[model samples]
Target: MIALPFLKSVAPPLQGKRIYLRPPTLSDYRAWASLRAESREFLAPWEPLWAVDDLERGAFRHRIRHYDDEAAAGTAHPFFLFRNTDQRLLGGITLGNIRRGVGQNGMIGYWIGAPFAGQGFMHEALSLLIPYAFTKVRLHRLEAACIPSNERSIRLLEKAGFQREGLLRSYLKINGMWQDHLLFALIEDDARAGK
Candidate 1:
């Protein structure tokens, strides 16, 4: 396992008032696929184009394996957000492209099931995740990018204390098309200031 230089010990599951985040497992395929299938239309606009077998169990298993590999390499941390009350899978979050040494930073991305949208679940999950990234993961900065039309995501990022940095032209491909995105960032000092 490639341990993070700043991480002296194993980190615990990130817990919040309404949700908890844990690494995805093979056993989570059924629930994950079901939620993604149900939320396909809701998520499509903000996500990458899905392959024909995206929701297949085999594909999901492969995703889990990839996540595990990334985590072990200390390049990313992928988590499934679950409701604490019922243990329902609400969404997924990833802090990817982690950089150490002089640049202690990572990029954050997330999605929520359609049924769970408009709830405060994601907010709570992010609250827990930000602190973990800053403290346990020792990230000095966390970045997020959202499509220009994604108002909800923009608001969520702002509410979580991220500052709108700039806009990137054709920054990423979403649903098979290159899309412009608004960049946002939060630094460790910003969190310390309670922003």
Candidate 2:
């Protein structure tokens, strides 16, 4: 069996050409809230409903604490995606529910702020992030599920080399009701071969 403590100790942070991935900080609260509030319209369809209080800095601090604990425990790695040149917070990316032993896998989740969508920053981040997950983390596979209607997200994942595995009937409760998601995955060997 793979050792959990070793994975926790060696969890890697990924940096991309345009974005740098880092652990969340309290200082990021205002920027995070501002981005979410401004992008509500753009992101609401894919995300869970947000309470009015969710936009407050205190709420964001709570979220940071949760993410920090998950990352430290090796259960997840939640990174704030930032523009490397300007250091502007663009959005967030996370690899969560990381499993070892017989699974050797993890699930990926991410979002880009409203203003930054379609700018190709996420594509760059994922391109770098996936390799780090596979090679450095030594995971056998990475998985992601996207609402079928999210054309942009589907395209982004495809561009980053994930293959469509199948559809999960009402796989997730998103934005309130159950929603179907197209499951996608990339095996480490396939990714290494540029497939």
Number of the top-ranking candidate, with TM-score as the measure: 1
lDDT string for model 1 (138-161, tens) is 899999999989999999999999
List candidate 2 stretches off by more than 4 Å. Answer: 1-6, 9-13
CA-lDDT, candidates in order:
0.90, 0.85
lDDT of 2 by residue, 1-195 (tens): 766543563345577877888877899888888888889889989987887799887788888888878877777878889998899999998888888789989999999999899999889878877887876667899999999999999999998899999999988888988999999999999898998
**What overall lDDT, based on C-alpha atoms, would model 1 receive against the true structure?**
0.90
Which residue runs does candidate 1 get wrong by more than 4 Å? 1-11
Q: Cα deviation of 105 in candidate 1 (Å)?
A: 0.4
